[model samples]
Target: MEPLALLWDGILAATDPAIFACTILGAVIGLLIGALPGLGPTAGVAIMLPVAAGFGGVAAIACLGGVYYGSMFGGAITSILLGIPGDAPSVMTVIDGYPMAQKGEAGRALGTSVFASFVGGFLGIAGLVALSVPVSRYALAFGPTEMTAMMCFALSLLSVLGGRNAFKGFTALALGLWLGMVGLDPISGLPRYTGGSMNLFDGLDFSIIAVGLFGLTAIFTSLEVNVDKPVAKYTFASLLPRVSDAVQTRWQLLQGSVVGFFVGVLPGVGASAATMISYALAKRLSPTPEKYGTGIVEGVAAPEAANNSASYGSMIPLFTLGIPGSATTAVMMGGLIMVGLQPGPLLFTENPEFVWSVFGSFAIGNLALVFLTLLLTPLLAAALFVPTAYLYPIVIAVIVYGVFAIDASTFNVTLTILAGGAGIILARLDYPAVPLILGLVLGPLLERNIRRTLIQSQGDLLVFVERPIALGLFIATVFVLLIPLFLKLTGRKKIAADEAEV
Candidate 1:
C-alpha cells in the first residue's frame, strides 16, 4: 500500500505541465540523436548532461532519462532503412531489418521494432520499480566496511567483464584512478596531486570528463569516417504493424524482456550483450531457426525488445547501489551529482518525491516515444540524408558550450580538450573507456568510505574481514575476478579434446 501510494505521488508529479513538456522534448531530441549513426545512448546522455544539469530538478532528470531510453527506440530507424546500425545494440537489427527493407517491408519491420521497444521498456521499468525499493531498503543497513567491499566488487566485475581484454580494461581503470586521485585528499585538507594549480582543487568533474571522452571524441572520430546515406523506402499503408504479427511474436518479446532485464541488472554486462544473448536464445527455441536473418519479423523483434529492456535493467544498480551498470548510466550518475543530488539508498529515504518522480517520468517517456516515433519516422528518416559535414560543427559547438558553461573555467576547457585527445588515442588502441569512467566515479566513494572505516577502527585492517557482509562481498569479488581465467582454461580443454577426437 505504501509503495502504491508513493508511486501514485510520483505519477502525479511527472504529469506537471513543465515536467511533461521536458520529458516529451527530451524524447524527441534523443530520437534524432540516436538515428544518427555512431552516436548511441552513452554519447547522447553525456552530451545532454551539462544542459540538463542546469535545469536541476525532476525536469532535468526526466529529460535525461528520456534521452537514455529514447535512443534505444531511435536506433531501429537507421537499421531498418539504411542497412547501417545507428548504435551497438541495433547491430543485430540490421541483419534482418535491412533484408526486410530490400523486400519492401520496411514499414512492417520498423513498426515491429517500435512495438517491441515499447513493450520491453514497459517491462523493464516495472521491474525497476518493483526491485529498487526493496533493494535500497536492504542496502540501508550497510556500514563503511560493507560499502567499501560492495564498491570493490562492483569495480572488479566491471573491469573483468566490461571489455574484450581485461588487462586493457584494468589499464583504463588505472588511468581513471589516477585522475580520481588528482584532487585534494578526501581526509586531509591539503592537496595531494593538484600540481599547485588552483583549478585542480575541486577535482575533475565526471561530467566534464564524460563530455570530452564521449561527446567530443565521437565528433573527432566521426569526421574521419565516411557514411553513405540511403533514402528511406516505406509506404504509409504498412507503417503500423498488423495485429496478427504482434499476437504471433508476443511470447518471443516476453522472453526477450525477461532475458534483457535480468542481464542488464548485472554490472558491466550492457545492452549490446543482452541483445546478442536474447537473439541467440530466440533462434535456439524457434522451430524455423533457418529463417532468422532472412527478413523475419521475429528476428527484428527479439533483439529490439532485449536492448530496450536492458537499458532499464541497467538502471537498477545505478539507482539503488549508487553504482552504474553501464556507461550511459555512469554519465547520468554524474549528472545527478552535478544537480546536487546523490544516488544511493539514502536518496530514497531523503527525497522520496524526487526518486519516485524520476521513475514516473520514465513511464511517461516510454509511452511518449511510441507516438513520437510513429508520427515522426518519415521526417526523421529524411533528416538522416543530411551530410555529416553539416552536423559536425553543430556538435562541436554544443560540446564546447556545454563544458565551458559548467563552471565558466578556461582550465576545465583545456582539460576537456586534453581528455578528448586522450580519448581518441585510447579508442585507436582498442582500450575500453567505460571502466575508466566507472573507476573515476567509484574511486572517491571507495576512498571516502575506506578512510572513514580506518579512522573508526584505529587503522586496523581486520575490520574489513571481520564484518560478515564485507567478507562475503570480497569473496564474491575474487570469484568474479577468476571468471575470465575459468573461461580461458575451459576453452583450452575443449580444443585439446577436439584434437584427440580427430
Candidate 2:
C-alpha cells in the first residue's frame, strides 16, 4: 500500500465520531492537568494510561495523543498568568508572557500562544506525516551500536546544551545514571544496587520520579514563595492579538517552527530544549536581540511556537522507531504499548489505523486546544487566587494519588516523595533536572545496547568506533564537551581586554 493511501485511510478512521469524541475529552483532561504546577504531559498521560488501556486501540491512541498537544497549549497559561512555569518548556514563555500579563495583555499573550501553538503544531504534524514512513525505514538499519551512539548524542546534547552550568548538568546526569543502575543488570542478571530490598529490584518508577521532581517539588517551592501577588485582570477584550503584532512575528514563527521540529525529532530533546534553542536562535537572528527579555511579541511567539512544534516533533521517533524523543512522547509510547500497539516500522504496516488516528488526532487536538484555552484561561487564572495553604495539600494529594495509580505500589509512592525531595534540592543548587530525567529514561537503553553490541562483536570495543554512525556520534559528544571550554576562554579574554581598557 502506498503511504498516501495509508494516511488517507488513517485520517478517515480518526474522524470517526467515537475517535473524535475521545480526542476532545482527552484534550480537556490534558489541558487541565498541564495547567497544574507539577503535572506535565508525561504525568498526565501516565496517570491516564490504565484508563486508556480499558478502551480499544484507536480510542486509546486518540485520547493519549490529544493529551499530549493539550498539555502543550495548557502549559502556557501558568507561565503567562502566574509567572510560574508549569513545565520546563513553558519557562521560555515566562520571559515575554509574564511581562505581557503585567502590562495588562494577559489575554492577548494567551491568544497569541494559542494561535502560534496551533500553527506550529499543525506544521509539525505535517512534518510527521511526510517524514514518519521514510524515517521508520531509515531507523530499521539501526543496530545496537547505532542505538548506543544515538543515545550518547542525545545525552550529550541534553547535558551540555540545557542550562547555564555544565558541571551541574553532568552531576545530574551521573546521579540519574547511578539511579538507573539500581535494578538488575539486563545482560548479566546480577543486582547492582538493590541494597537487599525486594522493592528496589524493579528500580525506580519514572512516573514517580517525574512527579516528585516536577509536581511535588513545585508545590513545596510554591509554599516557600508568596502566591498573593496581584496579576492584571483578563477580560474578553484582552483576548486577541493585534494584526500588526501577528505580522511582525511572521518570521519568528517560521524560524521557530523549523528549529523546534528538528530538535524535537532527537530522542530526549523535548519542547524545553527546543524552546530554549529557538529563543537563542531567534535572538541571534533578530535585529532587536536586546529587546527579547522585555516582553516583545516576537519573543513570546518564538518560544511558544517552538515548544508546541517540538511537542509534535517528539512523536516522530515514538511512532517510527519505538524510541521516545521526549518525556511526553515516552508516556505516549507507554500508552501505545499498553494497548497492544508497539511502535516501530511494523506499526505502519500492521496498525495503519492507529498510526493515522494518532497523527490526525494531533491536527484535531491542536484546534481543540485553541478553543479549550480560550474557554478555560479565565478559570485557570482565577485558580491563582486560591490561597497557597489550601492549594499545596491538594497538589500533594494529587501527586501521591497519581504516582500510586501507576503501579498500585506504596513503595512507588515513597520513591516519588524521595525523588521530589531530591529534585527540590537539585533545583535549589542550580542543577539541571532534565538531563537527570533523560539519563534515567535512556540508561536502560544505553546499557542494554552497549552490552548487546559488545556481545555481537565478541567483546570488541572497537566496533563502535568502526561504525560510521557510531563514530559520528562519538565525535559529536567530544565536540559538545569542548565547545563550552572554547567559549569560556574566549569570554575570559574579552573580559580581560575590557578590564585593561578600564
Candidate 3:
C-alpha cells in the first residue's frame, strides 16, 4: 500500500472509539504526571508500561504515544506557574516561562508554549510520517555485518553522548550488557547468569527493569529531594494565544522544530539537548540575545517547540532502526516488544497498518494536546500544588501493581524492588542510567548479530572492514568516541588563551 493511503487507513482506524479513548486517557494521566515536579516523561511512561501493554496492539501504542507527547506539553505548566522545571527539558522553559508569569503574562506565555509545542509536534509527526518509510527501506538492506556495526555505533553514541562523564556512561552500559546476558546463552544453550534458579532461565523482563530504573528510581529521588509545592498566582486570562506573538516567533518555531527533529533522530541525543541547542540557536539569531531570559515569548517558544518535536523525532529511530534514543522511548520500545511487536525496518513492510495507524495516532494525539492543554492548564497547574506525600504513595502502588500484573508473579515484584534499589545507588553515584537501559535493550541484538556475522565469515573479524556500510558506521563510531577528547582539548586551549591574556 502507498504510504499516504496507508496513512489514510490509519487515520480512519485511529478514530475508532477504543483507540481514541485510550489516547485521551493516556494524555490526561500524562499531563498530571508531567506537571508533578519530579515525575518526568521517563517515569510517566515507565509507570504506565504494564497498563499500556495490557491494552495491547494499536490501543497500547496509542496510549503510550499520547503519554509521551502529553507530558511534553504538561512540562511547561509547572515551569511557568511554579518557577520549577517539571522535567529536564523543561529546565529551559523555566528561564522565560516563569519570568513571563512573574510579569503577569502567564496566559500569554502558556499560549505561546502551547502554540509552539503544537507546531513542533506537528512538524515532527510529519517528518516521522514522511521519513520513516524511506529510512526503513534503506535499513532493510542491513545484513548481519551491517546490523552489528549499526548496533555498535548506537552503543558508542549512547556512552559518549548519553552523559557528561564517558566513564560513568560506559560503566552503566557495561552493567546493562551484563543484565542483557542474564538469560540462556543462544550459542551454548546453557544458562549464564541464572545462579541455578528456574526463574533465571528467561532472564529479567523489560517492564521490570524499566519500572525499577525509571519509575521507581524517580519516586525514590523525588521523596529525597522533597520539593515544595508552589501555588499558581494567576488564573488564565485567555487560552488562545495572541496572533502577534505567533507571528513574531514563527521563525523560532520552525527553527526549533527542524533542529529538534534532526537532533532527536540521532541515537543517544534527547529532547533536553535538542531544546538547549534550539534555544542557543534562537538566541544567537535574535536581534537582542540579552532579552532571552527576561520573559520573552521567543525563549518559551523555542524550547517548547524543540522539546515537543524532539519527543516525536526520537520515535523515528525507535520505529525504524529498533534503537530508542532516550529513556522514555526505551521503555516504549519495551512496551512494543511486550505486546509481541518487534520494532525494526521489517516492521514497515510487515506491519504497514500498525505503523501508519501509529502515525495517525500521533497526529491525532498532537492535535488533542492543544485542546487538552488549553482547557486543562489551569487544573494541571493546580496539580503542581498537590503534595508529594500524597502522590508518592500512589505512584508506588501503581508501580507495584503494574509489575505484578505483568505475569502475576511475586518474583517479578521482588526483582523490581531490587532494581529500584540499584537505581537509587546508580542515581546517587551520578551514573547515567540511560546508557544502561539502552545497553540492556540493544545488547542481545548486538551479540546475536555479531555472532551471526562472524559465523558467516567463518570467524574472520575483517568482514567488518570489508563492508562499506559497516566500515562507515565503524568510522562514525570512532569519530563519536573522540568527540569528548576533542572538546576537552578545545576547552584547555581556550582556558590557556584566557590565562595568557590575564
> Model-by-model lDDT, in order?
0.89, 0.78, 0.89
Per-candidate Cα RMSD to the true structure, in Å, reads 1.5, 3.5, 1.6
Candidate 1 residue spans exceeding 4 A from truth:
494-502
Lowest lDDT 10-residue stretch of candidate 1: 223-232
Steric overlap count per candidate: 0, 2, 0
Give the poorly placed runs of model 2, Cα more than 4 Å off.
1-8, 15-22, 33-64, 78-88, 91-106, 237-248, 266-273, 276-299, 330-350, 495-502
Q: Which ten residues in a row have the lowest lDDT in candidate 3?
A: 224-233
lDDT by residue (tens digit), candidate 2, 307-337:
8888878888778867676656665665676
TM-score of each: 0.97, 0.85, 0.97
Candidate 3 versus truth, CA RMSD in Å, comes to 1.6
Question: What's the C-alpha lDDT at position 414 in model 2?
Answer: 87
Candidate 3 segments whose C-alpha is farther than 4 A from its true place:
224-230, 492-502
Reference-based lDDT, residue 321, model 2: 69
The 10-residue segment of model 2 with minimum total lDDT is: 220-229
